[model samples]
Target: MASVTYILFVSSVVQAQEQANIEKLGVERVNPADVKAAEDIADQILTKMAEGSYYEFKEGEAIPEIVQLFTKDTQKQAYQQIKAQVGEYLSSLEFQEAYSLSQGGMEATIFRFKGDFSKSEPEVRVVLDRDDKLAGLRVLPWTDQL
Candidate 1:
């Protein structure tokens, strides 16, 4: 019984250490390289929308499953509101600029998209895990004069 307890405790410690390592290694660098990579993503989104309606970027593994689920449920409504203001999907839009780079225990990239002046400002937020990899993106609903 003593040996079994010791083994379990060791195993738990190893597992926790491994998780910490993964988080440390995965935390993507917050530099121009990362910013450009994200810009590439925004560019791809534009290209797909220009090509056709069925375009989608490949999913990043860093993104959590629950976040994906939420996106699935609310994407349509969220996009509808944004499209009404922005003129199309994420394509045909420019990353006006990053309004803020707020870092909490988890960091976020908050940016504004340039759309029609007549419409309300449409914004997108990308949440990152401890390692700085994208965990999910949230598109706010439209607040224009519908």
Candidate 2:
């Protein structure tokens, strides 16, 4: 079982209430199987975006349908933004860590990869909800923290 964990977000988007809830996460451990399943979904989505496909992510595999918080256009925009900042997505790093987090009323697992791009290597974060839905996903400026 995963131990109780707390996350502190200093981002401008996070408000006091949300931060409070986020700090309360970490009561149970998520199954490794769940992590793998979620990662597979994240990989598929990221791969498409990285390849500049900009297609719908929930393609053919509709069994465990993923309801993402972001829309198709949003996904495209985010990835495009990342691509613009970093350049083409040459490949994902050879090895990276996946993070599991639960806070407030949200529980999710994330996979962060050092994306090798044409000009830079930025951090790509993918988050999936406990129900295996897409909770959040984004590409952020590179940070060595993870």
Candidate 3:
């Protein structure tokens, strides 16, 4: 019984330490340049998406590969869904945070933003690949209440 209790206590402490280390690492891995580039891409994408003109950038205006990631149907569906839930876009996005990570020999940067819409504020995450092209974009319902 005593041995079990000691093991449980040590395990809990180790877990706590690991979590703290992860938080520290996240803070240390941020790159301001990467964050800025990712933010620029995210702003452009969000603006176009909200305006229902995503396809307009397909003809050599933006990164073709990144633009192709979301098909026309998917973009339309996502645009409609966001409009229905969040109403019209209110203002430019506010940057929240960013982090950098290595993935399969490539470096990736993820920037998070608070998007202000007419109805609700959503959290938008944009990931940029090593080539500074958008690799992933996700808009999640805001959980933080002001």
Q: Find the number of clashing residue pairs for candidate 3.
A: 0
Location of the lowest summed lDDT over 10 successive residues in candidate 1: 1-10
Q: Considering only N, C-alpha and C atoms within 3 Å, which residue pairs clash in candidate 2? A: 2-29, 4-26, 5-26
- Reference-based lDDT, each prediction: 0.37, 0.52, 0.57
lDDT of 3 by residue, 46-137 (tens): 67777777643435333454455566666667767677776666656877776554533545555777878777777766666557766566
TM-scores of the models, in the given order? 0.44, 0.60, 0.65
Model 1 TM-score?
0.44
lDDT of 3 at 42: 63
Clashing pairs in 3: none
Off by over 4 Å in 1: 1-30, 46-62, 65-67, 70-74, 89-104, 108-124, 136-146
Over all chains combined, what TM-score does candidate 3 have? 0.65
Cα error, candidate 2, residue 33 (Å)? 3.7
Candidate 2 residue lDDT tens string, 1-146: 11211111222222233443333223254455655665565567667767656546454332232333344665677677665677776645532566556556655555555657687766655555566655555555666654
Q: Runs in model 3 with CA error above 4 Å?
A: 1-29, 55-65, 143-146
lDDT of 3 at 106: 45
